[model samples]
Target chain A: MTDVLTAAPDVAEIGRGVLVAVLLAFVAFGAIPVVAGLAQFLLIPMHAVRNHYRETGPYLPNVAVLVPAWNEAAVLTASVDRLMALDYPPDRLRVFVVDDASTDETPAVMASLGERFPGRVVHLRREKGGEGKAHTLNHGLREILADDWMEALLIMDADVIYAPDSLRKMTRHLADPTVGAVTAYIREGSEDAHGLTRFIGFDYLAAQAASRRAQNVAGAMACLAGGAQLHSRENLEAIGGQIDTSSLAEDTVTTFRTQLAGRRVVFEPHARVLAEEPAGIDALWKQRLRWARGNVQITSMYRHLWFRKSVHPGLGGFFFGVFWFAILLLPVAMLLTSIGLVGLYLLDSDLAATVFGAAVFVPVATFVFMITMTISVDPRVGLKVWKEALLFPGVVSFAVLTGATFPMLVPWGGGDSSGWTLFVYSWLVLCVPAAFLVRKLELTRWGHRLAPLGLYLVGFGPMMCAITVDAYVKEYRGAAMTWDKTEKTGRVSV
Target chain B: MSRGRTTTDRATAAIVRSLAARPYRISSPVVLTAAELAARGGVLPVWADPMALADETEADRLRERRLVAGLVVAIAVVVLLWTVRSLLM
Candidate 1:
C-alpha cells in the first residue's frame, strides 16, 4: 500500500523527464545555422586588430581586365569609361570586351570603344552567341596568355563600375608570391534598388563581406565574387589558363584550385566595386537560382576536396565543409526538429510548449543578434540595417512554423494512436505556407524585402534547396553546362 | 598505388591514431558549430583522405569518429524513447 501510494506521483515526474530529453535532442540538431554564427563571433577579437593593406604604388601588376559581354549595350560604354578611368597606367591596363554575338548595339558599342581607345580596348566579336560566359572569358584568356606580358588578369562583369583605386587594392594582394587570387567588396549601387536589394545589400554585409573576413583568418575563402576577382598569371597557369567550363561556378572552382595548389585567395574589404542586382522578384529569382545552382555544382565538383590532406586546410577542408554541412542543411534540420516537437506535444501540452519554445527562441534570438553584429561591419549601412531586425518577428515565426510541423504526432508508447492527434497535426502542417495567405496585406518589410514574405519563404530557403536538388538530378542526367547569365540593368551608379 | 610512401605519412598516421583514441566531445551536436570550433581551435588539421591509409597502423580515424558519433545519437534517441515508455506509458 505504501509503494502504491508513492508510484502515482513518480509517474508524472517521469513524463516530464521524457519530454525534456526529447526536446533537448530536437534543439541540439535543429539550431545549427544560428549556431554557425559563433564562427564569426570568435573571430571578433582577431578582426578587431587593424587590417593594413600593402602600399599600392610599387606593387601594381600589368592587368588585362576581361569583360565578357552579350547584349550589354545598356551598361558597356559607361563600364568601359569607368575602367578607362581606373588608376592603373593606361599601357598596363587593357580592356578586352569579348562580345558574344549581341543582337543589340553592344557590337557597335564595342567597335566604337575600340576605335576611340585604339590599342587600349580590344573587341572580339563572335558569330555564335549561345556559348556561356566561360567560353567568352576563355576566348579572352587564350589571347591574354598568348601575349605572356599580361602579369595579372581581372575577370569582371560588364555592369560593374570600379573605383579609380580599386585595381590597386585588388592587385596588391598578388604581390605576395603565395597569394593567387583576390576579390573585392562588390556592393550593390542600384538607384532604384527595390526592397529586395536593400535586404540583400544588408545581407551581403554578413553573408559576403563580414563572413569572408572571418574566413580570411583561416586562409579560406569560399569564392572569388564574379564581379571583381583578380588572378595572377602563374596561378591561372597552374589551374590551366581557362576557367573550368565543367561547372556553372567557374570562380568558385578557381578559388578551390588556387587553394589546392597551396596559394592563398584573399578577400580585400578595402577594394570595392558597385554593381546592380535585379530590382524585381522575377529577375531576382533567375539570378539567385543560377547562383544557387552554381554553388551546388561547385560542391559536387569539389566533393573530393572536403577535409582532405592533399588540399590546404582552409577553404577545401574547413570553410567549404561549414558551407556544406552547416549552411546547406539548415532548412532540413529545422524541419526535422519541428516534427520532433510535435511528437513531444502529444505527450504533454503545457510542457511541450514550454520546452519547445525554449529550443526555438534561443537560435532565433541568437540569429537576430548575429545579424546585428554582421551589419556593424559598415556603420552607415548598419544604421538602415536595424530595420531588418523588424523582420525578427518573421524570423521567429519561421522557427515556430518549423517546430509546429506534425504537431499532433505522438507515439504514445503502448497506447492506441489517436485519429484526433493526426487530424490536429495535419491542420498545423498547413501553416507552412500560411505567410502566402497574408501576402496581400503587405504590412511591413516583408512586403518590401526580398520578395513578399510568402514568396521569399519559397524562394530563399525552400526554393534554393529545391534548385540544388534539381541541379544534382540534372547533373546526374548529364545536363549541358550552359552559362546562364543574369540580366543586369544599367541602373547602378558607383 | 601512386608513389613511394614517406616517413611523414607514417608520422601523420600515428598522430591521427592517437587523436582518435581521445574522448569525443560531450553532446557535440548541441554545440552547433562544434566542428568549426574544433577546426578553429587548432586541434584538428586536414587529415588524409577517407580512402587513404597513413600506414598499416593508421586506423582511418575519421570513419571511427563519425561511427562513434552516430552510435551516441542513436543510443540517446532510443534510450530517451524507451525511458518515456517505461516511466509514463
Candidate 2:
C-alpha cells in the first residue's frame, strides 16, 4: 500500500524524460536548415568588410563563353544578343555557339551571329549525340580546353539571359586566386506566372539562399547551378576538364571536385541571370523529377565524401541529399501518424484539446522561425512569402504525390535524363500518389481517422488552402530557371 | 631473368620518381606550351591504346566497388528496420 502511493510521480518522471528527448530531436531537425540561413547572414557583413575583390579590376583574364544549344529557337537570339552586348572588350571575349544539330532556327541564328560579329563569334556545328546536356557541354569543352589563350571559360545554357555586368562582377571574384568557380545568382524568368511557378520561385529563393549561405561558410559549396558559371582553365585541367557528361548532375560533381582540389567558391548575390522555368504541371513534374533523380545520382556519386578524407570537404553534403529525399517522404507520414496518435488519446480523455495543442507547438514554432529569417532577406516579401509559406503544407502534399508516383513508374534503370518518357511518368504517377498517401495516412492516423476535418479545421490542413491562395496571389511572371522556353515580353541588353 | 628485370624496373621507377619530385618553377604559359608540344610529338600514344593503364584503372575501380558494396549492405539493414517500423505503424 505504501509503495503504490508513490507510483504516480515515478510515471511523471518517465514522461518528463521522454518529452525532453522528443524536444531535443525536433530542435536538431529544425536547426539544420535554419543554421544555413544564419551562417549566410553572418558572412554577408564580413564579405563586405573584407572587400576580397578590391584589387580585381586590373587583372581581368581572357574568358571564353560557351553557349551550347539544340532546338532553342524561341530564346537563342535574345541570349546571343546579351552575350554580344557584354561589357568586356570584344577582343578578350570569345563567344562560341555550338549548335547540337538543331532542326530549328537555332542553327540559322548562330550563322547570322558570325556575319554580325565577324571574328568574335565562333560557330561549331556538331552531330546529334543522343547523350544529354552534360555530354554536349563536354564536347564543347574538349574543343576549347586546349586553346592556350582561353584563360577561363564561362559555361552557360541557351535560355540564360545574362545581366550585362554579370561576367564582369563574377570574374573579379575569380581573380582572388583562392576562388575557383564563381556561379551567378540565377533568378526565375518571366515565365513563372502560374500558381506552381510562384510557389517554386519563392521556395527556391528560400532554399538556395539558406543552403548556399550555409555551405559557403563551411567551405563546402556543394553544387554550382550550370545556368551561368565561371571556371578557371587551370582548375578545370587540375580535375581533368569537362565533368563525366555521363553523370546525371555534372555541375554538382564539378562543384565538389573544385572544393576537393582546394579551391574556394564564393556566391555573389549581385551577379544575376534570368532563366526559363517549367510552364505547366506536366513540364514542372518532368523537370523536378530530373532534378530529384539527379540529386539522387549525385548523392550516390559523392557518398564517399560523407566520411572519407579523400573526398570533398563538405561533411554533410551527402547526408543533406538524403534529407532532401526524406523531405519528400517524412512530413506527410509524421502528420498522419501524429493525427492517429492524437485520435487514440482523444478517445480516452476529455483533455484531447490540451494534448493536441502541446504536440503541435514545436512544428508551428519552427515554421515561424523559417518565415521570420526569410523575410529578413527581403522584408518587402513578408506578406507575399508568408502567404506562400502558409501554403507549404499543401505543396508538400502535392510533392509527396510527385515523389511516390515517379519512382515506381520510372525505375532508375534507364540511366539518366536521356530516357525522358519513363522519367516523366515516374513523377506523374507513382511518386505523386505515394507522397499524398503518406500525408493522408499521417493525418488520418493522427487525427483519429478524421483527417479531412483535421486538415480543414486543424493547423496543418489549412496550409493547403493557404498554399493555393498564396500561389494565385503571388502569381506574377518572374525570372527562374525553367526546362521549357519562356515567352519574352521585351528585350534588355546584357 | 628475374634479377635483370627487377633491377631495370627499379632503376626506371627511381628515375621517374626523382624527376616528378623535382620542383620545376615553370609558369602556367610555359607548362601549357610544353603540353602543346607533347601533344604534337610524333611518338605520342594513341588516345585509346593505353591498355595497361586502363587495366590498372579497372583494378582500382573493382576495389572501390567492393568497399561501396560493404557500405550498401550496412545501409540496407538500417532501411529494413525503418521499413518494418513504418509498415507496422
Candidate 3:
C-alpha cells in the first residue's frame, strides 16, 4: 500500500465535480420553493398596498364553525366556553361541536352547550366508521351547508382556541369573490410547553407567516390547515363540501383543489388562534407521522394536479409533487448518497479528501440560510432555539432509517387506533415506499401491529432520528400542518 | 356540584373521545360561553385576510430557512462522517 498522494489532483477534480453537482442539486431544490415563496411574499404586499384595506361592501357573511372532538373530555368545557364567547354577530355565526361518538361525557357537555346557546351552537354526532375526520366533517358539512344562510364554514380542531376577532377577521376575506378559503396564524399557547411543543410552536408561526405570504403573492396557496381554516360555503359546495375522506391531508388537498378551480386560498396573518402542542416525543412523532402521511396521500391523490404544465410550474402542482416526494425521500437519499460518497472516499482517501471540501460547502451554506430565516420568523424561540432547530437534520436521518426498517410496525386499524399507525406509516412511507405500501394494505384490512421487527429497525431506529430532523425542518420551514397538541400537565380553570 | 360532571368536564371528555375514536368524529357544537365566543367572533375581521394584507416578508424568510436547512444537513453529514473516521483511525 504505497501512499502515492500522486493521484490527488485527479481525485480533487472528481470531488470538485461531485461537489458542484450536489450544490447545483441543492440549489435547484431550494430555488423553486424559495422563488415561488418570494413571489407570493412580494406580490401580497404589493397587492395589499394597492388595495389599501378598502371594504368592498358590507354584507358580512355568516360563518359555521365546526369543532370536531373525540376523547378531549379534559379540555372540552373550557374549549366550548371559549368557542361560545366568539365575537361574531350571533345572527351571522354558528358553532357546531361534532361528537365522533366519544366513549365519554362529551355528548352531555355538547348537549348542555346546545341548550345554553340554542340556535348559535349546533350539536351533531357521528357513528364509528373506518373513515377518519373526513367522515365526521362531511356529516357536519352536509348538515351546515344544508342551511342557506351559512355563507362559509370554519374548520377547526377541538384543541384550537380562536381569538375573539379571529372569526370576523377570517370572514372578511371571503367578501372578495376570488378568495375561496382563508386560514389564520396559529400561536403557541403554553409557556411550560416542552421541547417538542416549543419547536412546533416556533415552526408554526414561521410557516404560517411564510406560506400565507407566499400564497398571497402567488395567488395560489398550498393549503388551508385544519387548525382554523375558513372556507366559503360557495367554494365548499363548488368543490364538493365533503372533504376527501380517504386522503390523509384533506385540508391541503382541498386547498389545492380550490386553487385549481381558479379561486384563491388566503393565509390571513392577523387572524390568530392558539392550539395545543404535543407534550412529549412519542406524541409529537405520532402527530407528525399522521401529518406527513396525510400530505403524501394528498400528493398521491392529486398527482394529476402536478402533471398540468401550464400553471406556474415552480409554484404549480408539479413542483408541489416533486417537493413532496423530495421532502419525504430526501432524508433517505441524503443518507444513501452520503454513505456512498464516504465509502468511496474511504476506499480512495486522496480522491475523497480532495472532493470533501467542495462537496460539503454548498449544502452547509444553504442550511445556514434556512436556519437564519427560521429564527427570524419566531423571535420568541430566539437565535439559541434556532441553534437547536439546526439539530433537525440529524434527527431526520435517524427517522429515515427507522422508517425504512420498520414500515409495517405501524398501526393499520381504522379510527383512533388507526390514527397512531396513520401517523407512523406516513413517516415510514417517506423513507420506505415498499414498506409503506405493504403496511397500507395490512392496516387497511385489519387494525393491529403487524410485526415489531419492522418497528424496531425503522420505527425506533435511525427512522426516529430522521423524523426528528424532518419535524424540526418542517417546523422551521413552516411546513408542519397543525400546532402540536400539548397535553395539559397542570389544571387551569378558565 | 353533585360531581355528575361540569359542562367543561363533559366537554373535555367528548373532545378527547372524539379525537381518539376510530372515525375520530365529534358532535356539532353549541356556544357555551357567549361572552368568550362573542369576543372571538369579533377579532377575526380586524386581522384575518391574506388578500387584504401584505405577506410582510415571512415567506421569503421561510424559503431562506429551507435553503439554510438543506445546506446545514449537507455539512452536518460531511462533518459526522469525518468525525467517525477520525475516531476510528
Best by DockQ: 3
lDDT of candidate 2 over B21-52, digit per residue (tens):
54421112112245544765743322112343
Q: Give lDDT per model, in order.
A: 0.63, 0.53, 0.55
Q: Is candidate 1 or candidate 3 better by TM-score?
A: 1
lDDT of 2 by residue, A393-447 (tens): 4544334323322323334423553334223222212333343343355444364
lDDT of 2 at A435: 35
TM-scores, each model vs. reference:
0.71, 0.60, 0.62
True contacts kept of 2: 0.00
| Tens-digit per-residue lDDT, A116-214, candidate 1 | 998999998778877788888898898889997788899999999998767866765565666778898887777765556766676676667667766
**CA lDDT of A410 in candidate 2?**
36
DockQ of each: 0.02, 0.02, 0.03
Q: Write the per-residue lDDT of candidate 3 for residues A395-473, one digit (tens) a residue.
A: 4434432332333333333234434322332342344433333234334435234422333233322333356455445
**lDDT at A266, model 1:** 81
Model 3 misplaced regions, further than 4 Å? A1-59, A127-130, A311-322, A347-351, A381-384, A394-494, B1-89
